[model samples]
Target: MNKLEIHSPNSPILLTASLHVDEARKAIASLVSDLLTESQSRNEAGSVELVTLDQAINRILAEDLLSPIDVPAADNSAMDGFAFNGDCLSSKDDIVTLKVVGTAYAGKPYEGSIGKTECIKIMTGALMPNNCDTVIPQEFTESSDSSSVTFKQNQVKRGENQRLRGEDLQSGKAAISAGRLLRPSDLGLAASLGIATLKVHRKLKVAILSSGDELRPLGQALDAGGIYDSNRHSLTGLLNRLNLEIIDCGIVRDDPASLKSAFLEAASLADVLISSGGVSVGEADFTKQIMQELGDVGFWKIAMRPGRPMAFGVLKPADPKNPDRKSLFFGLPGNPVAVMVTFYQFVRSALLQLNGANQTEPPLIQAIAQTPIRKKPGRTEFQRAILERGPDGRPTVRLTGSQGAGILRSMSEANCFVILHHDQGNIAAGDWVDVALFDGLL
Candidate 1:
């Protein structure tokens, strides 16, 4: 039998007194660890598909990248200079004259060896001929004849402008590790290693659903107590960047039977299911009941601002006829900002794990405040703000006027998020705070 990994804290499911932010994060982290491990192991038949360098962007590596050959392949000139023995250079007044033996251009190398006191005109990236030890810039060398050149008075030493073979990477060394999410720079690095193709993890298949009786499809006339569904389109945009295969399940009503049928249909086709709205304990909410009926629900009310209620669980078949399969399910709250934050904070890690990508640390910076802000201690808050360089050359953060949970416009215009910890609440002007840069978004 498979091990049961659902978490059950001794305290109530919902905290009465606000929890310390660190404690809350720790709890969530523990749950995420288990979730990720299970996800990784279940995907053990993990295979990598070979893709061309052009097609490898945003794909996760499925195997360790071993360098097949040494970089540079041989010592080369780093600048357009004269390649000669570096030990021949002495004091500034000691002008050393050497016979110019040949010229070396990029992609074409001289095959002959160099004699003592002989130099060669070499261009940048040109392979240094045999017996060459240093490169002196052409400007540093004064040529009396086309056949010979003399070093001018300068404080230069041996091997000053030579790029040694394998300086960047050695043969058989690890070029990139397994589970690395490919970035633009990573692609360049792999290309430098002569890797025209890479083995990458398969993209995740996800099913998306939106729930609410008051929600109507866009371009349709809205009935009383109804609103247009925006979560579906917003989530699709996010998933597009993640390289996920999305199956839009459309909108499910608040009725139990309809939700159950939608869940069944989605679970049959997707490895993961994401539901927005209808997870809270409101009277009209049917997602939570349907989720529990189909599988186990480990609901968490993380002590964090903007996003308080989030649900995670596995979705299985409710009827006995169809059984023995389950897919991961995440129920995000209905508020736009809440959904975005919770997905970034809680679900991003899980999704990366499922994709076989390793977790990377978020970028943080210290920015001085431009104005005073009021915040209570208890939960962590990510306030959107604009960052600008002050006269002192230090970055300063100015909060967007409103800190409301539904303010998506503020998030769009912000470049950074000021992280307000649970312990300290009151902040004064000019106080320094930790800012999480929105590098991923921008």
Candidate 2:
């Protein structure tokens, strides 16, 4: 396997005769790690702000939040039952009767303490009285009147159905840590701890654009050899799902001047500039030229199928006066499926890190291949596949029609990516392969 060389800003560019030349192909793991490291170095740590619990979902936590008070501030009942002293029950297997002193509803606790053979009718979430240690569910008792109840002895263990103070969360403990993406349950947890507002990192700003003379915007009439730009739409949707602020710069012509203008403008306004097409070694590919002139960019032939040509670096201001101002750049492939695959695999985690999120790569599960797959051993392959359960309840996967990079329908029809590792060759029907589900971002 060829190792990906990490080049400095002044490193010399390696040129090959063909775009598919196999020399110095970068491993996907190394490329992703480098990208993340670079992104972290450039990350500004985002601004902090206070947002109410209702508005905190999907926001990244900016600080470690220690709970000021314990959850369930007082000991409470976990079920609607009769709260009593368990020691009063007889050790023999016979009926144990108790006199109900009072009824304790939720939020309205019975103030008086219970004596031996005395109990209180408690509702769920009701605070337990001082002497009560166990609760017998109402269904287990045969109570004809509100005065007393009778149940079989040894029916419930001591301290059963009772919620202790600080059981869910203790005081002065970290309720939520920094860099955590707040979920609905997280909001509820915060609310339970009386945390009305939270400090969270500001949303990331991403500027996206597309390049190619043959590409036109949606709803525009296409001339000969021209196609609607689906990449921009797809990229926009993917970025929007991340809850980041997106600046769509639309399409730039393949001319050098037009490409240069777009890159400069994007760098000035956004934290990350993402462009599709124009990274390949075609005659009209001026994006590479302009990117290199403005900043330190590396064009790489990743050892992967579907998406091979990629560019990653930081774009600085072309003018020397603003040398410190820069934006991260990711140049993706032109094909629709390739763009999505590369973005999900490489760009997504980097952006999450930039957004102050605790980034974790999605795990790939082992699934049985339902059909024979022809593959080469040198390059990694990401084939669109439909995953389903087999007769034995094991996960099975099959390719989604054609595996062409340009085939957008393959991505639309598939639920996961059947990942063939770089060293793996061909696969039989029953072979176990790794698959990444599209449920997270898709």
Candidate 3:
């Protein structure tokens, strides 16, 4: 299936077509599946490249990474303790005294094994000696001289504090799987496995363009109807987080010629093209008209608040020689908050899949509502909210100042989105609600 593979432990998604029967709008999940299906059908998988461990962040793994050797290499001490044979363990009433043979540091091991009633003073991470199978922490042992150490017989169990070989990872085993989005922790793991270079997917090329005559670039004065082009800058930041190669195509006028030229140019240079504005119903239709001329496209009336109109399709380059060359297209609404909402809900996950990442869902947490929220039943609402600890130290969420589509400040002041589902209605104070956070607590 072309699903995004969302994972949830508690409540399952119950959104159905009957929720928006009056408007006949499509569901958000339906759109995501279609986009994924289109992406898979358009291209054979992207080629892989070899890169140093430091350069692999945010890149997708093309193959499984296997460990060449067992982790730890041998049995080792998990803490600073006295290592001795576990056969000496007895009743809690008995105290066992053993001769201290020698000391062992992290990288140094005792030359010879110890006999019964003998133990070695071992530091953390030091290899356990051949005759030792248990450890008694130094703090639990009574004061001991250079020759001997004393501890209660019931202090530790057999094999306690001894790290077994291959316990973390075995030799020739898959340490990291294919299609993983490499994080800093993943790099550390690869380094621990002695892997210096990784096979990863090449960077995806993305082109961003803004449409509308009223859109003004930086350093330009805005006229009565003109506004600064904030969407491009926001899109750039979002795409940068994924490490994609971004092309900033300046704003295009509403005319057919300009929109057509901009679309064709971006398609030629990028694997994916994202255009904001001019996609909604009754808006010139220049974007859709030009897109259809180049390739196939569809305009959707999604049943969601803040963002209702969306467009998705594939566009081919103007080049006659490479007729099969195409680029995936995402058309976002013009309203500032709507653009961000739709991007997070749809475009981000779709791009990750196209870049060869394993499909995964964004982290979500349920928080108690601090105040009443006015909402209708048919449409899904992505209401911006502030998530913080309440007086009792539990998470509590409250909506931002305004929930309008044009309120950019609402998105700015909020740290999360309180998702009121399609079939959901008004939320009262103290009611639990599902929240999608802006960033995870690392």
Q: In angstroms, what RMSD does candidate 3 have relative to the true structure?
A: 5.3
For model 1, residues 1-442, the per-residue Cα lDDT tens digits are 1212223323323322334445544554554565566656666564558999898888899888999998878999998878887657653557788888888999998777788678888899999986887888877766646698886646457778999999988899888999997889999999887789999988888999998888899989988998888888878877776777899999998788888999888987787899888655563134555665677655556668777776666777644553555677788888777777777666666677767778543568899999997888767887889998999999999998787877788777888788887767888999999998766632
Candidate 2 structure lDDT:
0.81
Whole-structure CA lDDT of model 1: 0.76
Off by over 4 Å in 2: 1-4, 7-46, 89-95, 139-147, 150-154, 283-286, 318-322, 389-394
- Point out where model 3 deviates above 4 Å: 1-46, 90-93, 440-442
For candidate 2, write residues 1-442 as lDDT tens digits. 1222343344523334223322322323344445556656776344678889887887889899999998878899999889998887645757888898999998899999789889999999999998898999988886636889988876788899999999987999899999998889989888877789999888878999998889988789989999999998999888876778899999999888898888888888887899999877663235666766777676776778888888777777765655556677788999999999889877887777766777546688999999999999878889999999999999999999889999999999999999898788999999999999998766
Q: Which stretches of candidate 1 lie over 4 Å from their true place?
A: 1-47, 90-93, 139-148, 152-154, 281-286, 318-324
Tens digits of per-residue lDDT for model 3 on 1-442?
2111122112212222222412222233343445556655775555678999989988899889999999979999998989999877854557899999999999999988798889999999999998899988999897777899998777778889999999999999999999899999999999988899999987889999999988999999888998998899888888888888999998989999988888889999988899999977677265666766876665666678887777766676877866667687788899988888888877777777777788545778999999999889878889999999999999999998879998889988999999998889999999999999987310
Considering summed lDDT, which 10 consecutive residues are worst modelled in model 1? 1-10
Q: Pick the candidate with the highest TM-score.
A: 3
Q: Single out the weakest 10-residue window by summed lDDT for candidate 2.
A: 17-26
Q: Rate the local accuracy (lDDT) of all candidates.
A: 0.76, 0.81, 0.80
Superposed by TM-score, candidate 2 places the C-alpha of residue 168 at a distance from the truth, in angstroms, of 1.0
Candidate that beats the other on TM-score, 1 or 2, i.e. the better one: 1
